[model samples]
Target: MSDTAPTAARTEAQTMLIAFDGSPEARRALTYAAEFLRPRRVEILTAWEPVHRQAARAVSMSGLRQADWSPSGEGEDPAYTEARETCREGVNLAESLGLQPRAHMVECATSIWSAIVDAAKELRVDLIVSGTRATSGFRGFWQTSTSENVIQNCGVPVFVVPPAEEEPDADC
Candidate 1:
C-alpha cells in the first residue's frame, strides 16, 4: 500500500439562513451559499414592509386618527405575496442545487434587517448568509445598509457576499 495521508475533515454548517430579497445581490448570496456552505438545513427568508396609506374617510379638524394602510394586493396585503414569491424563488434555486431549503416570509413595519436577525435567532441557525451592495461616501454613512446592519446585530456567524462590480461604460 502507498503511504498517502488522508485529507483533513471538512466543517459542515448544520443550519444556515439565507436572506433573499429576489434581487441580483440576494441571488448571488444564495448561489454562494449553495456552492460553498451547502448546509443540511437551509432557510430562505424574505422580509417585507407594509406600505402606509391614509384612510379614505375625510379627516375632521378636531382630531386625527391613525392612518389605515395595508400592502397593495387583492384581498390580502400584496407585500405578503411578494415576500412569499421571493422566498419561493430562493427555495427553488437552492433545491435545484441539491439542497433542501425552506421558505419563510416575514412582514415587518420596521427595518428588514431586524426581521432577518430575529429569524436567525429564532431558527438558531449556525450561519447567516447575505449579499451586500456596499455603499461608500456620504450616502453610505447616512444610510444604514441592510447587510451591515445584519452583520452588526446578528449573534451567529454571518457570511456576506459583495455584489459583483460592473464595468464602467466606455462612453462615459
Candidate 2:
C-alpha cells in the first residue's frame, strides 16, 4: 500500500467547443486547437441566421416590401443545411486530428456571438475556440468581430485564431 492518499482519477476527457463557419479562418482555428490545445473531446458549432430572418432584415434595410415567406415543411432551410454541412466538415477535421468530435448547429436568434456563448454554457466546455476574419476600418466598426464579442461575453476561456497574413509582394 502507498503512503500517499489516492486521488480520484478523471474519467472523462476534456471537452472543447469550436466555433466554425466553414471559413478558412475557422478551419485554421480548429487546426490550431487540435495541434496546440490538444483537447480530447470537441464540439464543432456552426451558428447561422435563418433565411426568413435574413429576408426580413434585408426588406427592412432596403425599404422593400416584405414578401410572404415561410419555410417549406418538405425541405430544410438552405442556411441551416449549410450550417450542418459546415459542422460535418469540422467534425471530419477534428476526427482527422484524432479527437472525438460532435457537431452542433445553433440559430443566431440574437447574434452569432450570443449563440456561441450560449452553446458554450450549455455544453460546459473547458474552452472556446474561434476564428477571426480580421475585419477593419468602417466595416469593422459597424460589424463587431464575433470572436471579440464572444470573448467579452463568455465566462469560459476563449482562444481566437486570426486569419493568416498575406505574403508581401515580391515586386515591391
Candidate 3:
C-alpha cells in the first residue's frame, strides 16, 4: 500500500427543496444542484389543489346556486382528473430520481406559490427550486417576469430552473 492522505470530511449538510413537475427544467435543476451544492439531503415537493371544492359542494347542495367555471378545475370539471394524474406523475418522477420525498396533496384551495411557501415552512427548508413554463414571445416573457406568488412569498431563497431550450429567452 502507498502512503496517501485522505480528503477532509464535510461538517455541514446543505439542503434544498426541489419542486418537481416532470418538466425537463426540473431535471436540469437537479443536475445543476448536484454540481453546485452537492447537498446531503434533497427534498422534492409538488403542489396540487381542489381549487373550488367547498364552493362546488355548496353550489350542488343549494337550489338557488348555479355551477361556476373555475380555472383550477374543481368538482365535475373535466380538467380535474387530468390535474390529479399530472400531480401523481410529478410525485412518481421525484421518486424515480432517488429522492424519497414527503408527499403532500393540498385540496386545490390556495395558489401554487402559496402552497410552496407553506411546504418550505413545514419542512424548514432553506431554498425553494421550481421551473417556469415555456414562453415564446413578448407577452409570454411579461407573464413570466410578473409572478408574485409561491416563488416570491417564500422567505428563503428561490432558484427557478428554466427549460434548456428556453433558457436564452427566459427571464429567470
Candidate 4:
C-alpha cells in the first residue's frame, strides 16, 4: 500500500472579501475559495480607477469649474461600467456556490490596492482573497503586484492564489 498522507483542510473563514477584476486568475481564486474555505459570507469588491480624461483633469487641476467641464459626448465611462459587470459576475458565481454574495464597486482616485485594503477594512472581513500572476523583466521589477500590496497594507488576513503554471507536453 502507498503511504500517501491526506492533507488537512483549513478552517472556513467567517467572512471573506474577494478582490475580483473578471480576469482568468481572479476566476480561479474564486473557485478555490468556494471549494476550500467556503466562507459564511462573501463579498466581491472591484476597485476601478477612472481613466476618463475630463474626470482626471477636473480632479487634478485647481480652480477648474466643475460646471465648465462637460463630457465630450460620452454618456458613461467604460471603465466604471466594466467594473460593475465584473462585480455582478462575482455575485453570480457566489450564488452558484450556494452562498449569498454582496457586490461592491468602489471608485478609487489613487490606486487599486488602497481601494481593496479600504474595502476590507470597511467591510471588516475575516480574510481577503485575490489572484496573482507571475511577471518578469524590467516592467515586472518596477510594477508592484496588487496581491503583494494587499498582503502588506491590509490588516486582515490575505490569501493570494497564484496562476496555474502551464505544463510542457510529454512528447517534447
Candidate 5:
C-alpha cells in the first residue's frame, strides 16, 4: 500500500470579507485570496469615519465650542463618498481577478478595525482577508495595526498578507 494519507473532504463554497482601503497591501491580500483560498463570494469593505464626528473630535481637542462648527446637510459626507469609491474600486479589481464580489461601505463608529470586525460578523463570512502595512518599532507600538486587532478579536479565521519585500539592487 502507498504511504500517502487520506485527505479530508472539501467543504461547501465559502464567503469571504476583505478589508480594503485601496492600498497596495490590500491589493496584495485580494490577489493572495484569489490565488489561494478561491472563495465563492467576496465582500469588499471600506470603512470611514463621518465628517461630523471628525469635526467634533477636532473641536473637543482644541477646546472650541460645539457651535463653532456644524456639518453641512447638503449631501453625503466626503469621508463616506471616498469610502464608497474605494469599495467600488476593490469590487472592480476583484471582478477582474475572477472573483464574485460585492461592494460594502461602513461608517466607522469607533475604529476601522472595529468596523471591519462588525461587518465580518454581520456578513457571516467564513474568512477575513486583510493586509498589514508592516509597521514596527515605536511607531507600530503606538499605532496598533488593524490586521493585528482583527486577528485578536475576530471569532472567525483571518488571512493577513504582509508587505512585499523590496527587491535587491542590481548594482549590488
Candidate 6:
C-alpha cells in the first residue's frame, strides 16, 4: 500500500484557516486543505514577526516570556517575509488543489501561534484545518502539538490531518 491513507478524510470547508509555514507538514496540510477547500474561497493566514525597532531600547533586552512572546511586540521585517513565503506557497498549492483561495499575511509579534489566533479573531474564521502527526513525538509538531496551540486559543473548530507512516522504500 502507499503508506498513506485516503485523503478523503477532511470535510468540505465554508471558511478555513490554513496556517502555512513552508514546512513539509504545512505543505501536506496544503494538499488536504485543497481537498477540503476545493473551489471554495479559503483564507490563507500566514503569521509573521514584526520589526523590533524598539527592542534595542530596552536596557536588558532580555528574552521574551510566553505572554510577552505572544503579543509581546513585533520583530524584524523578516517576520512578514516568512509569512509571505507561506502565502506564496499556499497560493501555488491552493491552485493545484483547485481551490479559489485568498491569502492574508498576519504580521504579529512572538510566534506563529499568537499570530494565528490574532488572525482568526480578526477574520472571524468559521473553522481551521491543518496537517499534523498522529502523535506528539519529539519531532511531532504536526501531531497533537504546539501547532495545536491555535486550537487551544482560537474559538474555532480545528481539523488536524493525522500523520501517516511513510511507505518503506521499494528499492529495498
Give the lDDT of residue 126 in candidate 5: 74
- Name the 10 consecutive residues with the lowest summed lDDT in model 4: 1-10
lDDT by residue for model 5 (16-108), tens: 899999999999999999998876578899998989898887788799787654677888888888888888989999999998898888888
Please write out the lDDT profile of model 1 over residues 33-129, one tens digit for every residue: 8887756568889988754422322343336765655545468665566778888999998888888888888876568899999988898887899
| Candidate 3 local lDDT, 1-172, one digit each (tens) | 3344322233134457877555677667766665565554567665554536646655776865766675543356544555556556665655666554444544435456776677789888877777666565887755543123665678887877666763465565
Write candidate 4's Cα lDDT for 13-104 as tens digits.
46789999998889889889888876656888888876564465556676655554444556667877888898999888878887778899
Candidate 1 vs candidate 6: the lDDT winner is: 1
lDDT of each: 0.80, 0.88, 0.60, 0.81, 0.88, 0.69
Question: Any runs in candidate 1 off by more than 4 Å, and if so which?
Answer: 1-13, 53-74
Model 2: number of clashes? 0
* TM-score computed on alpha carbons, candidate 4: 0.77
Better of 2 and 6 by lDDT: 2
On lDDT, who's better, 1 or 4?
A: 4
Q: Which of the two, 1 or 3, has more lDDT?
A: 1
Runs in model 6 with CA error above 4 Å?
A: 1-13, 36-39, 50-76, 133-144, 168-172
Counting clashing residue pairs in each candidate, in order, gives 0, 0, 5, 0, 0, 7
Better of 4 and 5 by lDDT: 5
Q: How well does each candidate superpose onto the true structure, as a TM-score?
A: 0.79, 0.88, 0.57, 0.77, 0.84, 0.65
Count backbone overlaps in model 1: 0
Winner by TM-score: 2
CA shift of 155, model 6, Å = 1.6
Stretches off by above 4 angstroms in model 5 are: 1-12, 57-67, 168-172
Clashing pairs in 1: none
